[model samples]
Target chain A: MELREMSRLLYQIKLADQRVATSFERETGFSLTRYEMLMIVNDKGVCSQSEIQQEMKIDNAAITRHLKILEEKGHVQRERNVANNREVFVRLTETAARELQHCEQNHDQTNHLIAKVLSESEMQQLSALLQKLNTI
Target chain B: MELREMSRLLYQIKLADQRVATSFERETGFSLTRYEMLMIVNDKGVCSQSEIQQEMKIDNAAITRHLKILEEKGHVQRERNVANNREVFVRLTETAARELQHCEQNHDQTNHLIAKVLSESEMQQLSALLQKLNTI
Candidate 1:
């Protein structure tokens, strides 16, 4: 195992991710993490905090901070169920959905960049390898 | 060209990078970027600043910041040669070499992780693909 090679490759991948994330934030006035949160909420509808934490694999405090930021940014809203009381659900605003369609352009460009960097076969192989590694 | 799949693979790569980089920093007490500068200087002794920037493909300002940090950390020293006093030559210190040796464990682990993630053939394919994409 050439650890240095792995480190260098890992660094490259991150640099690319950062480029895309920064673009998304700049274009939409929302952080990449915040955008990801909006995505899950939009897909699953109003859900409790635990679901976000589990799905994103982010720390509890990190999720709370991100949620707070998104709420403040007006992309998401939290409503406390009056009867259930303990259940807090997050909802994406209309603006969030509209922005998502806009943000896809940036995301698509970044993905194309990656695809251009790796062949179609390599992409599948990389994805498969990563899946195996993550599972183990 | 599936952005979602590409993002997943890229995310995994970034996660692995962060984990290894954080460990490297904790063990060596130097930032990953700083360590890379030291390594680059050692490989090509007393090279020009612009040369390092070209090789790293990083923004000049980022390189400048990392160089300053490395010089202050006693891992690197910069000097101006005659001819063009504006051009600087970078040299690595003995302490830097020793520390890099100590911190190399993380690098080795990263390599192991890569090998675990991909076979030798897959590695070659990925390297070739990434290099080609990088040029584009």
Candidate 2:
């Protein structure tokens, strides 16, 4: 593709992504990153901070900062591993699990609202195209 | 589309956008938002901060924060209008103009690298799909 066309494509991707993310945050009251972090913790039952960092592809400092806020909000608890004092493990609180269930419902609605624009075939084509583009 | 498929598509779009943005920043030493802000300043010659906030669709505090960083880095200047002290006008500096030109070149290279994976038809298809999706 030519430079201008390529730039326009990238711009469109950004705008669409932003629209979806904004709707998600508005509907669910959680940023997608934080929601994903909670999902990771919930999925693993209990996982190391490093594991969450790796899964999320975020740096240690960012992970720590996010965990701190989650902890403060009573959504998660962090504890040092007794077997490995330097390692911190995180898990969701009962409150978080309950709240996450509600968020999941809202997440579905937000996703539906955004994704309803394209037909099923167009959705598949977009998905396939994004898969190819992301391989870069 | 099913909720699962819709969620997956949103996730893919987010991932692809992040990949492109990360590469752009790494290659050009400028975030896409900051680059776009500079482009706006260059395009307008001199414009009010509110005008920029409107054009960019960002909150006033965010525009102020970004402009502060840009001003500190010698890329932009903000001055209060004498006739209307509440209004702040912004324009690019000579240094910023020169640097922005170089950044534009790097941006083209970055776009080329990411976009070269898709064929011309795929590129066109993806752009049209994203345009439709963004209408949400």
Candidate 3:
């Protein structure tokens, strides 16, 4: 692969990410990081705070701080796990689910726009390549 | 473009970005943001502050802040344009050029690794697709 092309690809990906995050924040008043946290919870149905922190690659303090904001905004709730008192589980509120769904449309549209240039087979190849990179 | 697959592609891109950034930071003691700023300056030769900030899609404040740290670290130099005293131009220092070239090996290796799974034709197609997305 051309190194310059690869660099440009990364740059474009970052630009798209920022644009989508900006739009999502404008519409929902929730930061992209917060939305990502909610997505992890939605995917897990109910996940622990540590799980979210680990998946998001953020520190405990940052996760805690964001969770508090999410809690205050009625987007999520945390409960201490009975089995492990130290573990705090997080789940999205219904309002969060609805908001997430709304933000998801913007995400979907951006993804769709990004993919509009490629054929189905090309998309498959691209996906396989990205998967390989991700695994690496 | 399968929407789910597209979403996964974005997720993978993010993971790879974080991985690369973390590695680069560990090796160079420079944040990815700082490296990006240097790249922009290198590309432009001698670019105005507003130009780099606009191309990077970062706010003036954020760009200024990073430039300050980069200047402190001897990675860049900002000078007032002779023709227009109000305009500030940024250019990479010799130290930054050396550092950037050293770090480019990591970037090249990462791109090489990412492309290893794809055939030459696939790489071309992928490159073409990414270029199209960038334009969009």
Put down candidate 2 lDDT per residue, A48-111, tens digits, no spaces.
Answer: 9999987776678989999999999999999999999999989999999989877565555424
Candidate 2 off by > 4 Å? A1-15, A102-111, A120-124, A128-136, B1-15, B77-86, B102-111, B120-124
Candidate 1 Cα misplacement greater than 4 A, ranges: A20-32, A59-61, A80-88, A101-111, A115-119, A132-136, B1-10, B23-30, B101-119, B132-136
TM-score of candidate 3 relative to the true fold: 0.72
Candidate 2 lDDT for residue B79: 94
- Ordered from best to worst DockQ, the candidate numbers read 2, 3, 1
The candidates, ranked best first by lDDT, are 2, 3, 1
Q: Whole-model Cα lDDT per candidate? A: 0.67, 0.78, 0.69
TM-score leader: 1
Error of 3 at A88 (Å): 0.9
* Docking model 3 quality class: acceptable
Clashes of each: 2, 0, 0
Residue B127 in model 1: lDDT = 54
Query: Which window of 10 residues has the lowest lDDT sum in candidate 3 chain B?
Result: B1-10
Q: Residue by residue across A30-49, what tens digits does model 3's lDDT show?
A: 66577667778899999888
Q: Which ten residues in a row have the lowest lDDT in candidate 1 chain A?
A: A127-136
Q: What is the i-RMS of every prediction?
A: 3.9, 2.8, 4.3
DockQ winner among the candidates? 2
Interface RMS deviation of candidate 2: 2.8
